[model samples]
Target: MIEVTDHDGVAILSLNHGPVNALDLEILTELPTALARVADARAVVLTGEGRCFSAGVDLKRVIDGGAGYVQEFLPALSTAAFAWFTHPKPTVAAVNGHALAGGCVLGAAADVTLMSGGTIGLTELGAGVPFPTVPLEIMRYACAAVSSLVLTAKTIGLAEAVSIGLVDQAVIPEELMSTALKHARKLAAVPADVYALSKKQLQQPAVQRIETLREQDDPGVTEIWGSPATRDFLAEFMRSLGRK
Candidate 1:
């Protein structure tokens, strides 16, 4: 799931489930807890092991586990995403590789997102799923081209991602962590109370929308994700990718 290490006063949280680090229930459940454990740190940096920030949800698991899984996973997804988005300390995403669908949302949720050699975008629609309320709202708050990215379900290169505000900076792969730490440390230098207050103020509207609409919206999103048609589509989509 997640590996936590302390670098000076900054807590660096690495996604340790290798082979693309696809989001699953356990990973999602552990994420917020990991953030909570490191709450006293001045800042946090999130990155993935290997060449992926994440490839997004594990559709194979979804299709295999069926609706029962979707019911549990959806809430965990929202919880983890909301926690990442609202973390009081300075948060930085060191996106080292592909960040698609949920992965993109996780990166964007951070106060500062920096990437190296990855493509990033919202591709959930391509998988025949609608965005859940929290993820949709976070993208709306963080990305300048949320509508285009979500609708098209298309991933763009680092340069375009930076230009469009999907990420704040594009660093070389070798320098990704260092650059992320630099940004994190700079933000960490701000007075904690002041920084937390400003972040909360800036994010209040999106946070409000998430709180107000999630109970209303997630059920329908979960229903679609659990539908037979969606399951069939996901099965075919996985086959097309040469996955099981």
Candidate 2:
């Protein structure tokens, strides 16, 4: 589900699941380990191999009672994303295509981001579930790029996404990888300790926000995830998938 290749001192991690790169328990469980292997590199670039970066967790997996398949699911996902967010090395999300829900969060979690100008959405409202608890640090970064999304159920196009600060740059699809690597190399050239310290300073306030919310979010998250309304919404959302 996760594949990694190192180029010079840069580590490139690609999402490899088939058909839209839908994230599932397998990917969720193993991604952290893969990320750990390359966490010490000078830089990291995360991109998907196919048409979409990811469509978030596989709906079918959840609908078919695959929930228990991941005993530590949500925590693992939150942790994996955090690992990327706090990586000592710079991390860039190379968005080649659509990135909805979890995929969108993954893109926003990066230290820097580049996109090919495609669809990106946080369609949790459409699915009738509570939005992900959104670590305060992640929310600040993601909001710059996609704040309007939190206000309503909508899919963000590339230009609008960039205008709002959801993505740093949008390039032609074919140039996405090269663009990402170019920036990654530039970031890699920064003095290690200096760069890491600057990055940490930028993220500290957000991290504090996340810690605060984590304590207050349990009630809301539990209600949303376990609600009958959410279950019904999930079913309908799956059935309506291609009609969009």
Candidate 3:
């Protein structure tokens, strides 16, 4: 689930769902509501508990849930991504560990990302899963180098992630939260109405583009998630994991 804690005026939303914090329908559906609750907070920090920020979606869940779940899931997922990008208050992602696929997208979607001690990248290509509009736009809006993630599926280390601007700050594990809080407090100091208006103005184009692309791209990708070809690929990937 989601844990909301207040730090001064900043709200930290920590996802703690089993090991690796694999994102599931539960978190996807709850995230927007969480953001709504923190609307008055000066700023927000999103992170995950345990060893990894998230290993991405719960793959087994996806393989088992089939098309019906994808239909219900993508909308909620996209909405959460949009919320991260356009939250009236500034947001930061304190990446505690490996963030891949959807997890990486979550970090990239934030206003500032502070990652600590692990690899983070989009590995969607190898999984035969496609990116939805909002995640793609978040990456594009955040950094230009992320354009290559769609074409490759490799995990990048802390230096590489920072060099590519996927992460704004890199720190030792102990320093992660303090560093994130420092930035959060800095942004939170901005007057609420002024911060909201400027953040909206800055994000409007990207948000609008995400909405535009959602109408055209989300359906096709959801169809692919349920398509026979993708299912076969997922099955083979599952078998490979079993062998490991």
Query: How many clashes show up per model?
Result: 0, 3, 0
Local distance difference test, candidate 1: 0.94
Residue 191 miss distance in model 2 (angstroms): 1.3
Off by over 4 Å in 2: 66-71, 135-137, 145-147
For residues 96-152, could you state the per-residue lDDT of candidate 1 as single tens digits? 999989999999999999999878889899889999999999999998799999999
Ranking by lDDT: 1, 3, 2
Which parts of model 3 are misplaced by more than 4 Å? Answer: 242-244
Best of the candidates, lDDT: 1
* CA lDDT of each prediction against the hidden true structure: 0.94, 0.78, 0.87
Winning model by TM-score: 1
- Per residue, candidate 2 scores C-alpha lDDT tens digits across 1-244 of 7899988889999999998898776787777788889978889999998888887777666666534533345566677777778888888999989988788888888878788967987776677766545533575665764446855758889998888888889989889888889999999899989999999898887777777786577556656665556667788888787678
Model 3 agreement with the true structure over 184-203: per-residue lDDT tens digits: 99887888889889988888
| Pairs with steric clashes in candidate 1 | none
List RMSD in Å for every model shown: 1.2, 2.0, 1.2
